[model samples]
Target: MRNGGCCPKLDPLPGEEESAVRTSHWRKELERRRDSVERETDGSNMKTATRKKDGEKEVRAMAPLAPQLCSRLAQKAMMRSSVTKSMASRDRVRFNVGGQLFETTSTTLANAGRDSMLGALLDDSWNPGQPEYFLDRNPACFSVLLDLLRTGALHIPANVPQKLLYREALYYGLLDHVRNAKWGPFDGNRLRLADSVPGRAPGDGTAIRAAPDGGCCVAHGSVVHVYNWMLEERRPISLDYQQVNDVGYIDADSIVITARERLGRAEGGMAVFSAATGELQHRFRVEHGQQPKSFTAGALSLAGPDDNRIFSSCKGRLNEYGIGMWDLNTGQQGDFFYELPGCSLGDADILQWLPSKNCLMVATLFPRTDNCFIGLLDFRAKTIPWSWSDAGIVVTLEDKRVLHAIAMEDGHSICVINQYEDLGFIDLRAGTGTNSAGTGVRWSSRSKLMNRKVPFEESCYPKLATHNGQLFSCMNDSISVFSGSEHVLTSTLSRSYGGSICDFSIGGDRLFALHNEDNVFDVWETSPSPII
Candidate 1:
């Protein structure tokens, strides 16, 4: 009758005597054979005939089985949340104190061996006798509430009784859900964590950049959270929710995003989400404890005709494992691409995909062996041989002819890449690269400090992009355009992105979008006549 390691909200731990008494309650479980034999022969009677025997052999009889012992052990392992149903009156009733709405009945399923502290609010007052939906029978409410607490959003069936009450479905994952099924326009904005004076998001007016097509993405949390920047009526509309570590535009409407979520108890790691709706379209979760900390998801290159045949880079734990393929259509491994005998992907490994040629480029990070190298893999080939990187941060110019890579002294660094507006001369077919060591295409930041020591351009790694033949990059609160090196600063200004920017996409029209990798982003465009 002691707490016996029960939930914190329940009875406390037992006294010394109770603890010691329970500790000695171990009993060897009935082996499968013995249990089977007992099932086959219930009574102690065994028939004996012939052999001059009076004929009756007694088998070992089962003792009066302690019923309370099995129940107690089961109680120790089973957990209860705020929503547990008790059979009140003749009808069975379910309870959910978390929602604060007693219903006719409900059923939830929680995972085993985990604790649900926030769900401890349910009690016995829930009753079904009055026709009020008090308690049904659900064990999963704990996980639902835990998810809400963690991500500030919860995905539930729309028909649930309390679904209407959820004007705000908050869950973890750095994204917010503003449910306005009522008549009103609702847009998903990135959740900003910096200073927000009450409901006013940080530099929201200054932040909030639109993508190339002219629409904005919701930004939130320590990391970047962009709803799939798909468009509607030339406006940015979220297709789904996606939390990605990094992203690259594969084509006009599709961009590959790397996403990961970490839940306690060995369930965590990276996945790939879609850029259209911000939804986790596909993911291969590597068990946190099962694999090495440095195991790669084989992102060195992604190629396919927009189907599910995806490949991953993995380590077998000892040395270089090999290249593995994933059949996205079925989420299974389709093929083993190749193997690097002693090579492996390090922390800053870079993977690039060139769709036109159906090839992939990979850069491996090893301390003293080789610099960044590029490799090409063909889905049609029998072997996937890796070509080392001459440099990291490889990118294509607007003209689609030239490729650019950042060159430094050491070999492990990957400078951020961004597309600056077409500010260079229209006379030149592509933009240019200028850094500390000219252009080695095989260098890194050996002794440079990222913040206080690295050069402005070296650390910032400015991108070059063109819109309407005008080259532009967001610099110091103004979108600066360049004609050759001659610059023209847009007098119109947006709020400052604290750090140098790296990523942006055309949200809609002339509305340019910009983000500082870690902070909230802002959208800017020249204004027409002030509309009423």
Candidate 2:
């Protein structure tokens, strides 16, 4: 212990040695407890990780089943809806019209159309849970309408008046159906004379225009007599003793009339009138030098049903002589085409608008002018794209002067007829230049080939019309029908009583021919072709 002699080393006390041993043992026990706690935590973390992995696997396995379940649910719902609709459509309905009981299916009433009165009964909110509907309407007409809805055919008993039937149809909103059933479709070959209406005035009708709805208006002097589809005379339009130059239907309810200018008036001629009430709705005015001036409108030409433009040849005391355009709805002037150098548009006897080419055909024929002038006017370019005239052409004895001209349906040529019953064709695509002077017309001897003799009476100026690929021409008392590409003579329509048709119009599945002898008019209708 005292080897170095610097300091002496002493042995530890007994109690201190024992306390150090106990402290060492307690330190080892605390380290052991800390190791045990770490092990337990690691075990708990492993369990949590395994549980999370199991949950992820379960979710991935169940994902495909969801869409299948939704698809099954949707299919069930659609099947249920379809079954319900089928049941509802087959539901029975009862109607008591004017104390007469009638029964039908919901499907039949649905055919009456939703806008019709009968169709209103099919609505679920309309008197729900009601056993029967009571309508305060005529039972006889109801029976006819019901049969029409069920069988798709209309048959009127002799006891029921036609006007009464039509009035009832209007109430039920079935007038269109009735009109279709009455007159099927227009066929010149299958036409049959349905009726002959006597004229109201003493003079021959100047014009006969067919209405959109199977009706017509006959213009005689200053009076225009309108007749409905039932051949019932409606209110006649009076022009205050002014001569009617041209008349046309603006719609089923309104008509545009062009009359000669008054003696002292400056601007009051063209007017629109209510077809039903004969009330004047509008008066068209012509302007020259930025001022409204008096002018006489002649030869009205309406641009198709969808177009809103009304074109007429206007003539005035001043230099306002040309084709005037007006708004059909507003009755205001839209544009004025001044007369060209050699073209007299103001005195054109025929003005026809060609929708396909966006041009208007102006024809100043033989009677209107010494020489016949036919021109195709392009409004957008303000130029005559194609024109033809007999001014310089030599006329032989066989060649007749063109009296009336109508553009063909194909829009490639124009068909013209003369007093001598000759049909001539003018090619629209013949020359590269606008002037068609030296280009001769292709004349057809179809009328002469048929060997038809002219009547002894004053030969009426033959009129030309084309409908549904068929060409129609009237000579004396007969209308010759031409068909096919070559326009071969197909048939002729004539009747004994009506002598020499003055004017004829075709529209709404009907043809109206006005006779010049007794101011009588004939109504021709075609039977509906059997549906295969």
Runs with alpha carbons beyond 4 Å of true place in candidate 1: 1-224, 227-244, 247-266, 269-282, 285-327, 336-349, 364-370, 382-497, 506-518, 524-532
Candidate 2 matches the true fold with a TM-score of 0.78
Clashes (N, CA, C under 3 Å) per candidate = 88, 1
| TM-scores for candidates 1 onward, in order | 0.35, 0.78
Error of 1 at 377 (Å): 2.7
Residues 1-532, candidate 1: write the lDDT tens digits: 4478675465546697687666665322346667878866754334323322442222122233446667777776563421242333223333454455532212221211113321222234533354443333332443344344444344455444333323122221212222211112211121122121111223222123343333344433223333322222222322233232344333334444343333233222234444555555555543323543333342434454465455555543344345555555565455544454433432224454445445544445423223433344565684344343323333423211112222111222223222232221111112222222223232223213222232335223334334443444443333434333222433333344444444333334433344453344444333222224
Task: Give me the candidate number with maximum lDDT.
Answer: 2
Tens-digit lDDT track of model 2 for 1-532: 6777678778898799999999999999999999999999999999999999999999899998989989999999999998887676448778899999998888888888989988877776765457788889999999999998987788899999888999999999998788888767787888888989999898778999999888999999999999987788999999888999999998889999998888886644589999999999899998777888888999999998899999999998889899999988777999989899988999999999998789999999987787888898888789988888887563653456888999998899899886678888988887733255535578877656667665666756789998999999987888888889998888888998768898999887888999999789999899765645
* Position 297, candidate 2: lDDT: 90
Q: CA lDDT, every prediction?
A: 0.36, 0.86
